[model samples]
Target: MGANPRGCLRACSLAVRSCLRSFIDEAGVPPAFIVGLSGGADSLALALTVIDVASRAGIEVVTLTVDHGLRTGSAHEARRVADLAASLGARALVETVRVDGRGGPEASARDARLAALRFLALREGAPVLLGHTMDDQAETVLLRLARGSGPSSLRAIAPIRRDEDGVTWLRPLLGLRRADTAGACAQAALTPVEDPTNAIDGPWRAADGSALRRSAVRHSVIPALASALGVDPVPALARTAALCAADDDALSEWASGLLAVSCEASPAAGEGSLALVVSEVSGAPRAVRARALREVASRAGIRLLSGVHVDALDDLIVAWRGQGPIPLPGGRATRVGRGTQARILFEARSPEPTRDGG
Candidate 1:
């Protein structure tokens, strides 16, 4: 806690050991091998720490570095990470991939990186590990808050997520900070690369600055609130997020039972190409209705959704006077006409019947 890199490294090692052991025991994920490596401090530290932990547990470790090919020195940096990982006692591999940075540069790089990791995991038959830290989550929440997002968005990111491709992605360092990750990497004698893009000011710069701001909010703002308002805002907000997640989970389960899955975006939709049917989304509770509509929109491949969009869908459910249809953010809605069976058929811009080809 004192900004000591060695201490942070030790703590990170302990955390990695605990998470890997627990995941093996509970999630049935094999411990013999884990995949993830980059020249970045967070990932390098994670790879080194995982090797130390897994070796003690009689498990083998492998490191995979995905060169996004976005920068000039990316491939060379990947090789350095591989060499360092090998010295750390992991069987290291590197794969360079072409990425266009489409659909927003950061997101596209993330997609390409994750796709490479998933491929590596499947090929190696192992779970892939990531180095997203708690600081990252806090920053994400702060960014979402600035964008006027909802509770789930404010919850930031999940520690674990599984893809339909059977890839289990784990973030064992969610409770650690970026500064701590750097400290750990230094203690491990691993020199991490500083991606110039990370420090550069651009549209994505706020994404990084948000974390610094969030730390201030957590360490400074919340305590100020506690002193002035006689309450800790951090704990209160965290508890609210937990409650919202619980309610959201329940709503999702209920909606799953009530609504039928018509189509899901395979490659996923980015713009207004997504759509869901009213037949499957109607007659549910407001919570369930919101979730169903969002899922449809998501299946249509939209990533960022606004609260207003959900509210508009809610209004459609209740105050819908069948006057054609209202305009949605990602797409337009049309009532089309009365159905043969007296049901109102609602369709979005792309129409409904497109299936996800995953």
Candidate 2:
């Protein structure tokens, strides 16, 4: 709609075009692609660029604005975003989700939003595009690091992820900074909705009056680090995430291969039961072994397997001293043999019988 300053709009358009072209080359062109628009600068810029790119390719763009219903006037904000999308010649939908607050408010809202996006993407057989920027990536890595996360956890916010249910999630803007998106929005003569919760000292706060974790990182920690080092820390932190992602990918591949060779499902033990060759697993490095064990536990129908559970399982392999059955989330792991024939058995615990028979 207007001239781009410093080519921010052009850069975003090029990035979207490249990502769409790559996906098309792999799976052929779809009728449409879905965009998660929140009326924010980042999503607005993404919507503009994607609309431009899809127009050229004769593809339709559908934007979904989710209202989490966490605050007042959320429905109005959703309508505003949908109106903008409709004005730009794209189909718009507003999804209202209830945040159960199972996790913290922030996390629960995200989960609800993602679930809505995934449902729409599946129904339309399209890819879902998000507006996560390099700044978001840096914040994610910093937050995970503060939690003492390992390499796999540190490889945060993948640019492209394909879920098990065949939903493709794409974040083409991860290479661009937050400022670039804001500039792009300005270039397009679009005024973005400023959500107060994103502000450093906004209305959202913890019980102790501290800002939200991400907001605090974005406004305070990142700037403080930059001031201390006399350099922008975002690029370096983003680079670290990229490096960790590469390493994690390699290790994951290796772990898969190791599992294929050293693990087997026991038919006699029924479903959700597997056995791992203790010697083969113990011979591998700790990093690869840890991943393999996690995979094994997942296959055994164990959900939410924590580090403590994994470590205890690992000890059964390396630090074995005739320990008893180690209980897991949904099952138990026990060593069944000794010497070279040792096998770690992961079996789902049988459901207990009801007191009153049906």
Candidate 3:
């Protein structure tokens, strides 16, 4: 295993082959040729492992590294990542992106990184591989809990997500720990760059609190749980996430059925509108109501709404009877009136003149 990267690759391949095969077999989607390389241990290991798999499966490989330019030496780091990818026999693409802290630095950087990866995938006409590991999942769950979020938050990050655009995001290393990846890099004699941001005291540090809790989840929680329960906590949590994902899929499908008729109307009319009699929508199952509101907001390109906002929309939907509009985030909503008709208005684009509009 130390001499041959194939050994570590084989281990990962066995663990993830079923997951990968299912996506391809059922969805008729092939393994994507694009791998995201951040020059970090996790992503480097992922690229090496992916190259090994591609060698066996006879697939082309393209590596993409995004330079966010947030710190000095970022460009050099991206170049190094590209070189490593090329050494591993992947066609490397280096993309330099500007990060505007519109949503704060970290969030903006993440959004930009994802957008870059998605752009690469679109241009290449393939799915994109992300290098999220088991530790990231645990961290996400803890962060969500800290924020007083719901059980759905416990489900945390996903292993795979297919968007409406047919581009698939795959996380093949979600089953591996960060330690395992670091060990693999050492064994492979790979010098993966360490991102300074991971160690800095910023929003991530503030959220995790003192770096001790963050390290505990990495070093303590899984081991303590294994000691007491006789099994790895991460694997167990991954399974729980899988079940939750399935449940979410079912709920989403049910919501789609409920929305089919109302959404089939002209996009302008029903794009963000739901037309059941006010009585019907109000009395619909709670899950159904939440799903419908989420779908509508989604169609209208509004994603800032939180769980509380969704709940409020549900309440409003059930209580409405007259023509006045039900308020929603991003200045969009459904106006319900007499009879069965409802108008979905993009308040941002509505021609109604403002006090200052001349």
Q: Model 1 residue 181 lDDT?
A: 87
Local distance difference test, each candidate: 0.67, 0.90, 0.69
Q: What is the per-residue lDDT of model 3 for residues 50-139, given as tens digits with 9 covering 90 to 100?
A: 776666667778898999998878898899889888988889889999888775566777899889888878887887888888778867
lDDT of 2 by residue, 27-139 (tens): 89987989999999999999988988888789999999999987899999899889999999789999999999776677788899999999999999999999999999999
Which sequence of candidate numbers ranks them by TM-score, best first? 2, 3, 1
Pairs in clash, predicted candidate 1: 266-356, 266-357, 269-301, 274-300
For model 1, residues 1-358, the per-residue Cα lDDT tens digits are: 1223358887898778778977888767574566677678888878878888788777788888888877777788889889878987898889887778576566677788788888878887788888977656655665577788654566667677688898788888887777888988776666788766564232343343543344455456545767998864444554454566676677788776654653333223234343444555566667777777676655554435567767776666566675555566545544432432222223335446657843
Candidate 3 C-alpha RMSD relative to the actual structure: 4.8
The estimated TM-scores of all candidates read: 0.70, 0.95, 0.77
Total clashing pairs for each candidate: 4, 0, 1
Worst 10 residues of 2 by lDDT: 1-10
